[model samples]
Target: MIVKTSRPAARLAALVLPLAALAGMGTAAQADDWTPTSAIEFIAPANPGGGWDTLVRTTSRVIQEEGLADQNFAAINVPGGGGAVAWAQIARDTGNPHKLFATSPPIILVPLAGTSQYDHTNFTPIARLITDYSIVLVPRDSEYQDLNDLFDAIRENASLSVGGGSAPGSMDHISIAGVASAAGLEAADVNYIAFSGGGEAMTNLMGGHVEAVITGAGEAAGQLGPDSEVRALGVSAPERLGGPLADIPTYQEQGIDYTFDIWRGVMGTPDMPEEAVAYYEELFAQMLETDGWADARDQLGWIDAYQNSEEFGAFLDEQKEEFSEVLSELGLIR
Candidate 1:
């Protein structure tokens, strides 16, 4: 099971900061010691229209519209090896502060799974922006009524399988494992099947290949309407999400003690200058207060989870250790 940790003070303060304070919080960044002189290359280490790409495009537009930065932020897509290709490029460009990229849990998971040579330690953390959650789904006509019922059924029938988008021991595996363990099932005993992506996982669910599907909340949003083919059993969010996800109850609300955070953030090349890091950190803290960012976050089903560099780096270390524990339980630790 995943051990939950407390949020950093910086993250807590970021959530309650008033608009006026947020506006002036970046006064320290006005120094000429470090600031982007040219257009900042904002990279999404995935194909266009994916989560990271959308975040990059949306962040660029909001920053440009809000007049947050002096230099324009240019969105770039560098897709390959599920982010390894772009990560390699960033690793080679040490100290390049102008090039920033969108990041999420895979920064840690991929490396621990032995897919990527470089990990979060190879990059300079800028700030964590928002957090998304995972959801458990079953076919609309399935007999299971909720997460507990499903776990009970799995217990009675050991052959049942839960499918997910990520490879075994990745986000999907860990998400399902976390809840299964919380539900009184052994993490290693749960039958998990991996698919290419969430779409495929959902498709297989509809086809009756898998007993259920567990995926990111936003990833499976569209198929979760009143008349949709799939219904949510429970969400891995601490609280219920907004919009289409608002109706879905969280695991805690359902008497299960579990929550999985799919945090999204920004990071720079390795050894990024401290001054440059400060500039971006302050810039993102300001972005969290923008009306555009607020709207984008709402539409994306994300929660405010801003964490400055120091807080983010510490959080990453904690997350790595936590994930390592869960991965070990599943015997897939690399």
Candidate 2:
């Protein structure tokens, strides 16, 4: 099950402010000695070892090592509702100047699906760090030759089971249904199993519990190693990827008009102190420039797509509408 919650730590470490802030378009006092002296909490809206947790942890490490903040940092897992729990907390923490919440495409999708209580307008966009492409994976010796081959099977047998690492109405499941719908298969005809994290879903796929798996390319790279025979038939991007997994063809290249770009970003409460918001944005900017960040990206096979508060907010609004339409067409949304 994909478990998630919005509960924060019962006891916080402290309420602190540090000197030495970064430059940005904010009040002069907000930039003055802008450092966090307390243990900064980065809430991952999913269980440990999943995409959200991994991204937040890696980012926290990069920020700390680069001295982006003056004090040590911490991250907590608050998984559920495809990130509803974490998002809600961030939205409620309007007065909290110390907390930051990790966000992505699913953050937008959750509210549009009516699974989340709050919408994108509830939070303050901090920064957009990376964008990931989704991939279609099958076991090493599956008879399917390519994306076309797999969809052909699904079309022929509408009950063909598919798996993903998100909830019923979330991105992972939506990608599979989107492709199936485009290929003349009823979205509801496909069987999809939701796993709490990619690590767990990958296990089921390898164990033959599901016929195929849909996950981000970055999450699948670990299992798609050179020694492993697991094949990525299609990437949900405009073109092919460029890296160790560059050889894989996109769904578009396979004549399937589909795309799913997972944008990972950060957010704070709607009324979080201006100084606190600036502090986080500056830290994220610094993190993007670190060698550690680059190493993590390569290890995860993720693409670099960074945006600040303003740009990220606009992107979020656009995606919310775009994905909501897709979900509604599939009958996953009202």
The per-prediction CA RMSD against the true structure, in angstroms, equals 13.0, 13.1
Candidate with best TM-score: 2
* TM-score for each predicted model, relative to the true structure: 0.77, 0.85
TM-score of 2: 0.85
Per residue, candidate 1 scores C-alpha lDDT tens digits across 1-334 of: 9976567966776676865576666654455347798999999886654557767888899999999988999999877655767899989999997999998877887778887898899999999998889899999899999999999998999899999766566787888988889989988778999765566677789999999998778656766798998999999987888888889989998788999988889999999988899899999999999999888777778788999999999999999998887788767786
Q: CA shift at 247, candidate 1, in angstroms?
A: 1.3
The regions of model 1 sitting more than 4 angstroms off are: 1-34, 37-39, 47-50, 70-72, 77-82, 139-143, 152-161, 195-211, 219-223, 227-229
| Prediction 1 TM-score vs. true | 0.77
Model 1 Cα shift for residue 84 (angstroms)? 3.5
Residue 310 of model 2, lDDT score: 81
Q: What is the C-alpha lDDT profile of model 2 across 54-161, one tens digit per residue?
A: 788888888777766777668998877778877777776676767777777777777777778887788888889888888889998999878778878877886677
By summed lDDT, which 10 consecutive residues of candidate 1 come out lowest? 24-33
Error of 1 at 62 (Å): 2.0
